[model samples]
Target: MTLLRDLPLSALRALAAAARTGGLTRAAEELGVTPGAVGHQLRQLEDRLGVKLVRREGNGIVLTRIAEAALPDIDRGFDALASGLRRLRFERRADTFTIAADPSFSSLWLAPRLGNVRAALGKLDVRIVVSIALDSMLEEGIDLAISYRYSSARDLASADLFTERVIPACAPTLIRNRSDRDGVEMLDRLPLLHIDQTMGDDVYPTWANWFTAAGRKRKNIDHGPRFPLTVLAAQAAVSGMGALLASELVLRQHLDSGQLVEIARDVPALTIKRRLVWPVDGPKARRASAVAMALAAVARAEADGLRSAVS
Candidate 1:
């Protein structure tokens, strides 16, 4: 007999809501229960499972590492359950497909290039959930997702979206003498753009990493004004504020439009992976197949263009 089968789902729901909202009060508000009631259910879940899923940090509750590992699965399960409820409640169209992606990725990359897919699939209702939270899509029944995670749960299917080749890029006007001197040599003269945070995480690439990759290791590698998102950093680079070391895949459209120019095309740097993932079959699985095809088509175009730009 499975031990998980004996677990009360209401307690699980309370725990998932708390994990999602990051607080008991908000989780109670969301679940239509009192804060104390939510806390009670959470304690019940912990006791039943014999694990401390959360710990108090000041007035707010924070997930333990074990909870962090389990929350994604719980979120995904609740998302599918909600989708099933929605399907039962209302009539839906066969052509509609919902996709979830980070706000920065949606704004910088997909928003500009999605027209191609829309034009190709004129019969589909494409819904985009611009969220930094990876679980938002899963919880809301999105058909597909683009995430920067290196890997995911074993049950879902995923494919590589594009090559994440990190290179230095800036506006055309910023590099007047880039041809006169080596691009790597111009690094000390031009400002560097730093991205201190990306999406939900505070960790991202920096000017120091790029310089060390190029064998420079300058002492003053941390010399640029920091931005919160890669999109903002890329835009600052395009505005001539500084050169940004970002993924060539994300910067391909800007590079193609001549809004941004690669400063260190010959330098090889770190690779950041992004993936497109979907379930094998669900309520919206058929439409998801089409959306996946559309995404794969776009991915090919992007990869090909980046190759041409680099070579």
Candidate 2:
């Protein structure tokens, strides 16, 4: 007879992640553990069971028959254990919250307001996962999400967060040299910086879009050095590498501080809307509501502050 009490949760989790992700390296990345550690745990589990769970292939791993046979039951057991743990922890801690959001917004906006949340709750932990992929809240164990999307979530309770508004921006020195230049003229003189495609569909208002919106054309829309993210692209523009189209929300502080200056401020703005989403039922809903309230308060405060500063 085998004892279920002898199984380690970490070893079981490693197996499931490896099975789901198709590799140990990917599982390690998602679990925030070393690949060696996950591999070790997998090997330990196989040793305890006296079975070969996986085998090394050419630069990859293949699951053995035993692993396949054992995993479905292991996954079910993990799910049940997770549900019980969540309920117990929720009942005990009662106030800590976790959220999932876009990386840029989480870093640039929400992080600054955590002090406010901490003050309100007395003690709270807000875990934020920043990825472009829209995660399943229940599956991923996230309480709330801030995502850019065209339609509101009817399946989940949701609220409007904010729209993205983009404008051409560059170092103040570049702006000072040609303060009177329009969008087309500025593009002629400056290296038109392009954002690398890593941000997926969310990164828009490209130079092409901006030029089209302005009823002008620029041949270098697809040209110039590409950066991996807005943070890097914006940094390049701030250093006078070239002109950049950045969200007014993200660049407001820079604009206010004179680090980056907008070109053709009168041109029509380009915008994309975003929203807050959460499950409609369960304890997650209460946690989601609390987070939403905090987010709304913070966003409103930021908007008001920026509006006043701009005025």
Candidate 1 matches the true fold with a TM-score of: 0.58
The most accurate candidate by TM-score is 2
Compose the digit string of candidate 2's lDDT tens values, residues 1-311. Answer: 36677768898898888878878899999899999999999889888878898887776677898788988898899889888998886665455567776566677887887786664443566677764444356655556777765334465777877777888888877764554444457666678887754322454567888888888876656888887667777888888898888777777778888888888765877887767777777755766776687777777887899799999
Residue 236 Cα positional deviation in candidate 1, in Å, after optimal superposition: 1.9
Model 1 misplaced stretches (Cα beyond 4 Å): 1-96, 107-109, 112-124, 131-137, 172-183, 200-204, 253-259, 301-311
Provide the overall lDDT of each model, using Cα atoms, as 2-decimal numbers. 0.74, 0.74
lDDT of 1 by residue, 18-40 (tens): 88788999999999999999999
Weakest 10 consecutive residues of candidate 2 by summed lDDT? 196-205
